[model samples]
Target: MGDFQPEAHVKGSWGLNFIALICKRSSAVFFAVSLLKSIAQMYKVFVNDKPIIFTTSFKNEEDFPVYIYKNTIIQELIYKLKVGKLNGFYIYSNNLIEDWKDFKVKFKVIIAAGGLVLNGSKKVLFIYRGNKWDLPKGRVEEGENLMEAAIREVEEECGIEKLIINKELLITYHLFIQQNEYRLKETHWYLMFSNYEGSLTPQLEEGITKAEFKNKKETIEALQNTFANIVMVYESYLDNID
Candidate 1:
């Protein structure tokens, strides 16, 4: 089978920090603080807009169903995901890191980096690929750190220059299949700015058909056809600015 990605609702670190700030000022704050920390570091994998969270903390959110990690069969969850049986779900566990390690082993993990680039007009960069609007990104290269990879990928894919990373926005995980094997892509996203007014060139070899900058209204329209993880990155950027 060719690469098939099934796509984040989390607002990233800024939202977490907001919760921590409020929790620290409350009466029964310690429990809330600890709970926040546990969830912050947990494994939250996204399928479209649905999150499969693995955590030690019990989620009382009521939006998604929760199951005990130890008692759950991973394959069953995968089946439910494929059939659209669940919007989202949680696997609660006392041992979160260990459970995450075990869970991730089921798929081949690939690390990648990307940028949400903004030019002087506050317009965002977008690429059209596989009939979907997408941001520029690619797998991390050997010996290159995530930040370096993010800059390089955007520059190469969009053929633009004079870019600077403002800060790391968030990390996203998406599952895809290639050669009949499940592969999970973990992408580190960064908020970036550029002043280059040069022509935008889409890397045709990479299947990117068009590259252009979009204003706020245009970006919103594009998001309707973009990946769920890209929405998470955009929301994270908003949080950072706010």
Candidate 2:
């Protein structure tokens, strides 16, 4: 139903030995192995708040849930993706969906809005939230619209101004356990772009650590270096660009 999108990348050389790009939504990791020489510019994709997948040879083929395939055997799979032999990642959606609620006692749903701001080429602006790479977003405040809250969250987190919400992206839902209770968070995502380029000052008071821009290549590398949500977002973006 949707076209697969190949995000534009600024190429360079940086040979990653072996990479494991973890996915968030389905608990799978779809990835490729490459002999990168040097890293030029790059784009960073953060799902929820982790880096999962990255590559220099990213292409949009047929849309497949193939990205969500997982290898049930963990040790063997990690060994393969680490030692530079496996060229592809096996994703298993059932791994997460089947036992996802076992850890939760009970949960309540909440509404939130967030922004995915892409810079030049395929570079995206992200903040180091707590210990993870994340886009700026938060809960909707009283007297504020969802979009308004989305814009406000980005500005407060990244300390930028005047973000133009381009296109709306897919909404993602997951349950979080806080204070011995489950909290359901439904996020409204937007493809937000802007012309203002300024210093990024993460709101440390709000738990943000660092703020920076990563070109597509660096961002791809971050997929292996960071967490899983990043991979899912990239795949989602690939689906979006499609």
- Report how far residue 186 has shifted in candidate 1, in Å: 0.6
**Per-candidate TM vs. native?**
0.79, 0.57
Q: Rate the local accuracy (lDDT) of all candidates.
A: 0.75, 0.52
Worst 10 residues of 2 by lDDT: 33-42
- Superposed by TM-score, candidate 2 places the C-alpha of residue 86 at a distance from the truth, in angstroms, of 24
lDDT of 2 by residue, 120-197 (tens): 555787878656677777998888887999999999888888689877775545445568644657667788877767
Model 1: lDDT equals 0.75
User: How close to the true structure is residue 145 of candidate 2, measured as C-alpha lDDT?
Assistant: 81
* Model 2: how far residue 117 lies from native, Å: 0.3
What TM-score would candidate 2 get against the native? 0.57
What is candidate 1's lDDT per residue for 1-242, written digit by digit as tens?
11212211344565555444433433223232223234544666766545677765654546567899889997788668767897667788787767877887889899899999999999999999999889999999999988999999999899999999998877778887789876889898899999999999999999999999999888877766666677657766776784
